[model samples]
Target: MARKLPELKRRKPSIAEQQRFILICEGEKTEIAYFKALKAQYRSAQISIEYVAPAGVPITIMDKVKARMAELRREQRSNPSVKADTVWAVFDRDEHHKVTEAIAGRQVSGAQVAYSNPCFEVWLVLHHEDYHASDDHHQVQKRYQKLDRAYDPDGSKTPDCGFLMNRVEEAENRGERQCKSREDEGMPFGRPSTTVYNLTRAIRAAAEASRPKRS
Candidate 1:
């Protein structure tokens, strides 16, 4: 009889664990909708995107973010997996007086700020074209609508995610270029600039990490 081969142990395939990201937004509808759409587009088994829209000024939104961060920390003590890998405070510099305070609060709370000057619509406008002019929320919104007729034509203030999602890479590139231009002009936090691309970059990184690896 042929000798039986020794039994070999099979190694188990590792399952990817989901990374948790918590985002607190100042806008009740538009920002929330945009981020939700982003989460849907980059849906993955190994990534979790959560949003909290406090619908307030930058300082108030930062307060909510701090509270949520505290709650998550407490939860992590019992279950470490519940810990959030990153927390972001999303807000616009729309003539808000406490914008500086809110930005400073991030250092103490260890949360990142995805701030847009004039308004969040500045980011939306970047998806279609490069904008460097100083404009308020109204102007930016009008420009966005002009660029994409399908966006908020009914005054709903909701983003057209279908049109926006496909152009994320283009927006990111344009935003980064504008940021560089601003820095070169010695106005790092100038109007018509947005750090929203930084937040999106983080989201994309998490999604990429969640992708399955081929043997």
Candidate 2:
């Protein structure tokens, strides 16, 4: 006889849903997974969260995010009840950071958006902020030596920060690799959501606490 499979069950929503919105990120799969995890945890809460991009695209991230914020602000201005929520622009501090100023100048054109009154905000996550693999000096040295011949043919030592940021790319690549490996093995993979997860939850909790006391 074949083994019986576990029974499937459906979970019901428990909390009243509120509305909240945030700018999504522009990066690889790792970035989206983080957002999805946080969304899952807060989905039942009295909050409605919307994202700017479900598919990661670096070129349009900043522009699209700013556009979304402007749209939200415009709507909020007309409708007092509607409010601008937080925008988290998460990016990797890989080689991209070196060219970000130029990219920001040409690609992203506009003033940054701030959140609504009472409690409004923005968040930024640099590649190295959460976790980094190249912090392992041994690995960095190994990788640097391999790339030195082509990148620094003259053999002069490269700046540590620049080299480290390059290694940050390696870290990100490794993360992508790990994610792929999990998928290949038929398993789910994701980042630890302690930081973004807690931040969003705290925002919701604080908002709830500060809401006008009900009669």
For TM-score, the strongest prediction is 1
For model 2, the local distance difference test gives 0.39
lDDT by residue (1-215, candidate 1, tens digit) is: 99999998765655467667778777766787788888888886233344544367888888887887787778888797663557788888987898989999999888889999988888988888899988878888888888777667347757787678989989999999988888999988788799999988888887887776644
State each model's CA lDDT, in order. Answer: 0.80, 0.39
lDDT of 2 by residue, 58-119 (tens): 34556666676677778889987764465544443232332245235323444222111110
**Prediction 1 global C-alpha lDDT:** 0.80
In model 2, residue pairs whose N, Cα or C atoms come closer than 3 Å (at least 3 residues apart or on different chains), thus clashing, are 16-46, 17-46, 18-46, 18-47, 18-48
